[model samples]
Target: MQIPLSQPDITQKEIDAVTEVMTSGTLSIGSRILEFEQKVAAICQRRYAVGVSSGTAGLHAAMVAAGIGPGDEVITTPFSFVASANCILYVGAKPVFVDINTKTLNIDTTLVEAAITPRTKAIVAVEAFGHPGGMVEIEQIARRNELILIEDCCEGFGGFAGDRPIGSFGRAGVFGFYPNKQITTGEGGMIVTDDDRFADVCRALRNQGREGMAWLAHQRLGYNYRLSEIQAAIGSVQCDRLEEILENRRRVAQMYMTRLLDNRFLILPTITDDVHMSWFVFVVRLNDLFGPTERDEIIKGLRASGVGSNNYFPPIHLQPYIAGPYGFKEGDFPRCEFVAGRTLALPFYGKMTELQVDHVVAVLNEQLEKVQMVRKPRI
Candidate 1:
């Protein structure tokens, strides 16, 4: 009865693809990797895509390619995974974090322009929990300011904002393919962009800074961030099935929404009009009346009842590594702190059944009732 939080949807097609790669003599820097890149680029409607070891590596390469280096400032959201901000630090720059919108759980566009300064080199906009809310406006702001916009689409693979795809909006977008994502490659990422020069730089950076296919000619200092041919083979198959996977995830999200819509103690995710959501994880927030302690107790109760759940994200700015260096304290970004404290990521995946979804909802409500009882004033 124990339901895990997330699972990748792997079919026999992926198995065959990987097995074929195993038979092939060339395991790395092979045709499969090139095919994977082309598939990702076509999906994003971008001119180029570079497969990398991970999303973090792609982000680092993107910043470096953009010439964002020492003494520069990159505006980003504090509510995202730490890597969103850490990437800026990787390129020897500072991350100027703005608060997020409580509804979309993405960066607040209204606050973005004010955060920009002469030192600002880029804006790293993350589609938190796979929600793309202010991306278009953020892109506009970046263009107006002549700054680079790096869309961190790590949680948003098959998502779309209006007619444009998630990775097609920014100067360069990065997508992660961890086991829990919409599509997975075991461990890999893709860097999507229309700029050929940026694509070339990323390709070189991911392969030990080589200028071309030649392995020995080192052009610049770079890390070993190349995605393996075996991983690419799996990713290519996953790309082919992206639409089906996205539809299944959307159905699961709808199921959760239908059950939790009327619950007074919970707040569901926000989906804007004209945006096609790619549900990465089904995260719901406990209402303001309940705080973090109560939320944690509810999660504990669910786990005790053989249900799996987790806090999807802790505020990036509040992490010890950033807090000490950036002088960030409590109340710096109240909305982000507020949302982060109460988020509970329930079991979610493309293959999840209605029975399992119902069981999770039942468990969640039972635990919530217990917390409510304890909080009641015993007059």
Candidate 2:
């Protein structure tokens, strides 16, 4: 039974692509990287794409390219992967936290404008759990305030906000290809943008600040964030199969929904009509009657029963690194904290079978019922 939380779908095609690159003489900054970047850019409907070593590198490069430095403020949601906020810190800028929408789990657009200030420089909007909700309003807010919009599309590759792709909404969008993501490059990321100068800056930032592939010339201080040829080759093949992968993920998502939709004790993911969701980790939340203690117990019970589960995110603002320095405490972002407390990411992947899904659901229900018996007053 031991269903793992998440897995990557890799085929023989991807294996062959990696093998070809490994045999090729050029390993770094080669044609494979160019092909991968081109495929990503076209998919995002952007004119340029820069391949980087990781999603964190891509976001940091975007912040630098946008001229976000010390004393500047970047607004973002606390209910996201820590990198979404950590990227702001990398550029020596302050990350101004905003609460997220309870249902969508993305940053609440209503609170975004209020968070903007004279020093506000950018908005790092995340597609939480791969749902591109409220991005249109966030884009409008950024535009009206003249703020740089860096879409953190790390969890959202094939998603769309209305008719437009997820990466098309921001000034520069970043995608990650970790092992657990929709696609994997072992470890890599891509920055997509229509702005020529921004694209050029990111390209330089990933290659030791070299301008136009000069071997020894360094234009500015930069980190070594270049993606290797082998990773790029794998990414290129993954890009070719992106649509099929997404469809498979969607199918699994539907299976989970069909099985769990009637559970009164759990709250399933909310997918709005306007956005086409790219399924990442399928997370479910315990109802209001259940607190963090109950949620933890359920997760532990599921794990003990050979079903993998985890809290999708702990609030970024409450993390010691951010909280100690910024003086952030509990209740700063009530909505985010509330949702984060109960959220549980279950086993999810494109190749997951119906029997595995059934096992996970059964374990979850058994755990929920056990928790309910112990806390009868809340029920």
Writing each residue's lDDT as its tens digit, candidate 1 over 27-117 gives 9989999999999999989999999999988898899888999999999999888889999988889999999988889999999988988
Cα displacement (Å) at residue 24, model 2: 1.3
Candidate 1 clashing pairs?
A: none
In the order shown, the candidates' Cα RMSDs to the true structure are 1.0, 0.9
- Deviation from truth (RMSD, Å), model 2: 0.9
lDDT of 2: 0.93
* lDDT tens digits by residue: candidate 2, 266-292: 899987788798898999999999999
**Steric clash count of candidate 1:** 0
Pairs that collide in candidate 2 are: none
* Local error of candidate 1 at residue 36 (angstroms): 0.9
As a TM-score, model 1 comes out at: 0.98
Q: Which stretches of candidate 1 lie over 4 Å from their true place?
A: none
